[model samples]
Target: MSMFDNISVVKKANVYFDGKCVSHTVQFPDGTRKSVGVILPSTLTFNTGAPEIMEGVAGSCRVRLAGETEWKTYHAGESFDVPANSSFDIEVMGDPYHYVCHFG
Candidate 1:
């Protein structure tokens, strides 16, 4: 099979919340395979056993791990990884918060 054969374009979503706009593009591969997600200027909390990479392009935000009361800050040109099975929350803290997320 071609490298991208098993990949299917799932859907695209745009969301607006708390005066911020986010765009999401989801892609799914074959059986039990990991999916890819692209997000723009969005805060997310993961509830499954998937690893993710979040990158900041502009503005800033904070990430709070599950069961933790502290937040780790991220700014423009910064990136962080979310371990498998971990729960985390993010919030945009500065103007024109822009970020990208890739999950699998």
Candidate 2:
């Protein structure tokens, strides 16, 4: 039950947020899709239709979960969970934020 046991990569993706972010969609053997992206320095809010695990692969950012008053910072090898049908804010403080979003 290890991660990356049967993965497929789709190398190219459309630039999102007017070029502030770019992501490649990848798939797992179980048919789950993940978006691996690099986000430029900016504050952005995203809505999740399903539960998601956002993993930080490089750089850092501060995130405020929906209905939360405090902001948490995540760096390389860190991850956070976002609830389904909720929104969260991410602030990139002058560095690109690289992440992989796994949906469930």
TM-score of every model versus the real structure: 0.57, 0.87
Clashes of 1: 0
Give lDDT for model 2: 0.88
In model 2, residue pairs whose N, Cα or C atoms come closer than 3 Å (at least 3 residues apart or on different chains), thus clashing, are none
Q: Which candidate tops TM-score?
A: 2
Question: Clash totals for all models, in order?
Answer: 0, 0
Question: lDDT (0-100) at residue 64 of candidate 2?
Answer: 99
- Give the lowest summed-lDDT range of ten residues in model 2: 1-10
Top of the candidates by lDDT: 2
User: Which digits, one per residue and each the tens of the lDDT, describe model 2 over residues 1-104?
Assistant: 11455689887795877888788888988788898888999988888899999999889999999999999999979999999999999999877998988899
Instruction: Estimate the overall C-alpha local distance difference test score of candidate 1.
Output: 0.62
